[model samples]
Every structure is written in structure tokens, then in C-alpha cells.
Target: MQLDDLRQNWETFGAENPMWAIYTGRGRIEWDEGEFFATGDTEISEVMAVLERHGAPSGAARALDFGCGLGRLSQALAAHYETVDGVDISEPMIEGAKALARQPTGVDESRLRYHLNTKADLSIFEDESFDLVFSLITLQHMRPEFSRSYIAEFCRLVRPGGVVFFQLPTHRTTALKRLRGAAGRTMRKVRRSLLGGEPVMEMYGTPRKDVEALLTTGGLRVLDVLPDELAGPSWQSFRYLAIRPDSGD
Candidate 1:
């Protein structure tokens, strides 16, 4: 789908969709019984492992999940942090997230709240309000220039020595996939357009060096870059963990 059309659909369906089911699916609301992406337990486990590897704070840590569609990862984070906020640009997504909080998940729903807004501009939050900030499969939707500002904002919102985790696809592997066959090539083009172009977005793919530079330049220290293999079958995607440097550092 074209970027403009996708945005329009999100805006329209965001406010009108009952159950806000479209926010969790591929595009707009197309529900599949027991086949919801947001219900997967592996997502939560992966996120938790990423956080744990990066030394995420426990007991009184404040965390924020950017682009938290339906609050799946946010719900997981709530288990370790004292306070957790999930932010998304879609209102329907937020609604779905809120509804999930009432479920019997053995989690402290009191510590979870969903915010409807863009991560590029988090003015509603005070500076340095969170100890950890994390996002998954979301940054690709932003243009590169905008992504720089978004990362800057994430760094600004996190307290000194805090951690930030993000997962993104790379261009090289994507290009390779395109070369493999017609189906792969077609999917590649579609994904590139859905996500923004390179440098701001991870359309085709991005080199490890470029990704590290972007993170470091945005005032974060690259702590680890777990390659595709480490993430099992999802090796085409990469996970990044970085830390907000102390003021003096």
C-alpha cells in the first residue's frame, strides 16, 4: 500500500474499528480466529531476553514501549518495571491495548497505561522520565530524517545510563532475498515502500556499521548487535541494545 493511503486508512480505521482488531493485523481490521499476531508468547519472551541481556532495571524502573501495538510487549515489560507506558500513533491500537489490560494476565494492570501519540514527538512526557525505552518492528515506518529525531527523542526521554532496545531489518539481506526469486523480489518492493527508504528506514537492508553509527551519533552507546542467527528463524531481522551515556561521558 502507498504511504499516504496507509496513513489515511490508519486514521480512519483507528477511530471507527470496533475492537480495534485491525491495528494488530497486517493492514486494517482483518480478523482471524486464534491467529492474532499480538497473542504470540514468543514476542514477549524475545523482548524479555533482550531486556535482560541489556541489564534492564528491576524494582522501580520506568519504561516506555514505543509504537506498542495493542500493548503486547508493553504487557511483558510491566512485569519487570514498576511503571510502564505504551505509546502508539493509532487510537484503535491504544483502545485494544487498554482492553487487554483488563484480561487476567497475572500482571499489575495498575502500572500499565497507553498513550496515543507519535514517538517522534513525546512532549506529553517529562524529560528523562524513563529508565528504559524499547521498540520493535516500528522504526521502519519512519523516514530516515524523521528517524534521527525519533531516536534523539528516545535518548532524551531515557535517564542517564538507561537502556534502549530496537529491532530493524537490514538492506543487504533484503536485496539478496529479492535476487532469490520472483516472490521474494515482489515482497521486497512492497516492504520498501511500506517502510521509508534507506538511512532513515531499513527498507532493503542496512549494514551493521551504518546502524551502529546511527545509534552512536544519536547519543546512544551501542552495547550489542545480536545478529540474525541468534534470533532463530527470524535471523533476517536484527536486534540492537544501547545505553544512554551519563552526562559527563
Candidate 2:
């Protein structure tokens, strides 16, 4: 699927089930702030632990959270970073995030912000603007072309010597699963076109070498890559921690 197609699906998904859209398995349950934000805390905590283990350079003043649905992790980030911007391509998600930010749960709402960006690239922000930028479990849902473009953008927007943490599907599914995936995508397209059903969420995987090459092309130094099996064995995932070269470079 294309970028526009992915956006449409996420917009519909966010409207219908914002929490479940962010974290599946909630299964049509109503939005519960306690449960949803707790899940976000779990993710951020785990990522922070990795960053600490690798000496990823904490003390970040400004941080960017890409594909930040409903401000779940953004709120969690407020404790570490001076300023946190939660950005998403879906307007419904951003609106829900704004409402969540106003709930007065002592999240330092002033430091946590939500932005809606529908563009293919992250041109809204300037070069070397953020101390850290992260996108988790988001780019995999996008098309390969868009995913590459954003990875390049992440490299550009991050400050020199800053850190970046992102997750990518390192390999495609097996032949049998590939066949099933293709058929599912085709049927979803047909159903959406003919029956007017909501857009179906789509996922794509990129090779590990291809992702590493993109990181290099963007002037990022690969610090480490760890296996992450979020999507099961069919689609292997990896978490990459990279650093932008010093300004002297």
C-alpha cells in the first residue's frame, strides 16, 4: 500500500478504536487511560533501559516521537526530556492526543505537545533540531518508499551527536505467509472499494542490509541492532540505535 492508503487506514482505525489502534489486542474495548498509558510506560521504560545500557546519551532537551498516537509515550517522555513533541499523520489521532494531554494527570502538559503532519517528509522541522528522535512500531505500517524517506529525515532532523531509536522489520515473511499477506491485502482493497468498509491496516518489511544502507546514506552511524520479535517469527523485527556523527564530520 501507498502512504496515503496507510494514512487513511490509521485515521479510520484511530477514530474507531484509538487505544486499540495504538496497541492491538484491546479488542473494541472503550478507551481506558490507565491501561493505555501504562502500556506506553512499559514501552518507554524498556527503550530507556536499552539506551542506558548502550550509553545512548540521555539529558535530552528536545525529543521527537514520530507516529505518536494519543500521546501515550509522549506523556511518559516528559519525565526525561525537557520538551517532547508527539507527531502523527492522522488528525483524529492528534485530536485524541490533545484531549488526553488535557486530562490533568500531572504530566507537565506544557512540555508535552502533539502535532499533526500529513506530509510525506518531515520538512516541518529544521535540521539538527532535536536531541533525540524515535519512531517505534510505526514505520512498518507504511510503504517501503515512505519508510526510507522518513529514516532519511530522522537522520537530518537529529542534532549532531544525538541518538535515534527506531524499529524495523528486518525481513519479509515466508513464501506461504507472503501468499497469505498478498491475498489479504488484495481482498481488503476489493472490500474497501466495493463494500465501502473501513481501510485495512497494511504492513511491509525491509531487509536488514537495505535498512543499514539507508542509515549510512543518511550520515548515521549504526551503534547497535538487536532482534525484536514484535510481529512474531513470520516478520522478524529489529531495534536499531544509531548516532548522528559529530559536527566535525
RMSD of each: 6.1, 1.8
**Reference-based TM-score of each model:** 0.71, 0.93
* lDDT of each residue in 107-167, candidate 2, tens digit only: 7767888889989999989999987898888988888999999999999998887888999
Candidate 1 per-residue lDDT over residues 1-249, each given as its tens digit: 344443444455455553333333345465542344344345667766776766766568888898786776787777678988998877777887788678766357779988987434778888888888888766655555555566667877888878888766554344455465346546656776698342111233445677778778767898888764322232366778888888887
Q: Against the unseen true structure, what C-alpha lDDT does each candidate score?
A: 0.66, 0.84
Model 1, 12: alpha-carbon shift in Å? 5.9
Clashing pairs in 2: none
Q: Which stretches of candidate 2 lie over 4 Å from their true place?
A: 25-31
Residue 41 in model 1: lDDT: 49
TM-score of 1: 0.71
Please count the clashing residue pairs in each candidate, in the order shown: 8, 0
- Model 1 whole-model lDDT (C-alpha atoms): 0.66
TM accuracy, model 2: 0.93
